[model samples]
Target: MEPAGRFITFEGIDGAGKSSHIDTLAAAFRRLGETVTVTREPGGTPLAEKIRALLLNDAMDALTESLLVFAGRRDHLRCVIEPALARGEVVLCDRFTDATFAYQGGGRGFDAKVLSILERITQSGIALEPEKMRDPDLTIWFDLPPEMAAARLADARAPDRFESQPAEFFGRVRQGYAERASAAPQRFVRLDAGQPRDAVWSQLTGSLVQRGWLQAGTSDVGASAS
Candidate 1:
């Protein structure tokens, strides 16, 4: 199921500004003449969106929550991500399996081994092709302290189930993200989200340039032209 297109995922604790910059990055890619597919985890297709609603609002046990997310992921892969990537479009997803690991495994104290099993089942199914488990080519992890992230989200909106968790929970989630990045350093770029917005943007753009996703001087011009 791995496709020719690149998959990029954004990760962070809530309110780390991942959402703020996703579209901007996608626009940059489009400027480079890459077809971009913007999507999100626990939701993408119709069924997945409905599942997302439940995952966000409904109270569920940790195992139940993990299973639901994997179900939604399966539908998302089959309906949206795979096809777009097959067509050579860059897929910019808001989050993916990483969130499941962070939220369910790290935050909720669920068993990582159980998550691994479900991950394989949902990603590759019975066919058992390891390569079929689609992983992002690059992950931009916006690193922020849990308290600061909580402060930022204070007045944003009504907290969802995950967002309603305490700062200690978010701390665990942050650690989860950090561990994932450490385990996959080459595929991850960690940015300090606590910086000023402009500085953060600069780092993001710089990372892209370093990765050869953008030409140094042409980004602005190409973006404007597109």
Candidate 2:
């Protein structure tokens, strides 16, 4: 079936201020009569959420961590993501394989080759032909300095495993995300997270509207986009 839905993902390190914008974007799409399914990685499905708990709190080797999240990803795909797309609903995922690559491969210094192989095996087909690997149509990356990100999280809720990583590790993860964005420039939009909150939202919403996913006036914020 031709998937009519759009798959967009919001990504960034902890405290890049990505979490606050997703639902608001979903609402904008809904205003345009689009059905938007907002979900998150390593935790979209029940089983995936179980895996998320382990990955977040437990200490394990990087390889083990990668395997668990991929397993969760597979389930999340089959159970939640794919179905929503099949029904023509926009999927707004908080994170996906990129996060795994960032946290495990980049942060933990795991083998990227292994992550690539796992990604191929696990995500070969979902909303597309069986031979094609599915990817988000658009990825909005809030690029923030690791130091500033750490500062944002200072008094926030307690961090999970990845969130608690040192500045050096986050620096690596940021680079990892940069590498991914570089590899797929068309699919990625990098936002300077240091900008004022209004500016960040302007960029984020403008991205969607600019892509023609939403009408010109789609974003009350991105109306500035026109």
> Against the true structure, whose TM-score is highest?
2
**lDDT tens digits by residue: candidate 2, 47-120:** 99999999999999999999999999999988988889889999999999888888888888999999999999
lDDT for each of the candidates? 0.86, 0.87
Expressed as tens digits, the lDDT of each residue in 120-208 for candidate 1 is 88888322255566678999899999999999999988999888899999999988888888888998999999997767777878888
Please identify model 1 stretches exceeding 4 Å from their true place: 125-131, 218-226
Q: TM-score per candidate, in order?
A: 0.92, 0.95
Name the TM-score of candidate 1.
Answer: 0.92
The worst-scoring run of ten residues by lDDT in candidate 1 lies at 217-226
Once superposed on the true structure, which residue ranges of model 2 sit more than 4 Å away at CA? 221-226
Clashing pairs for model 2 are: none
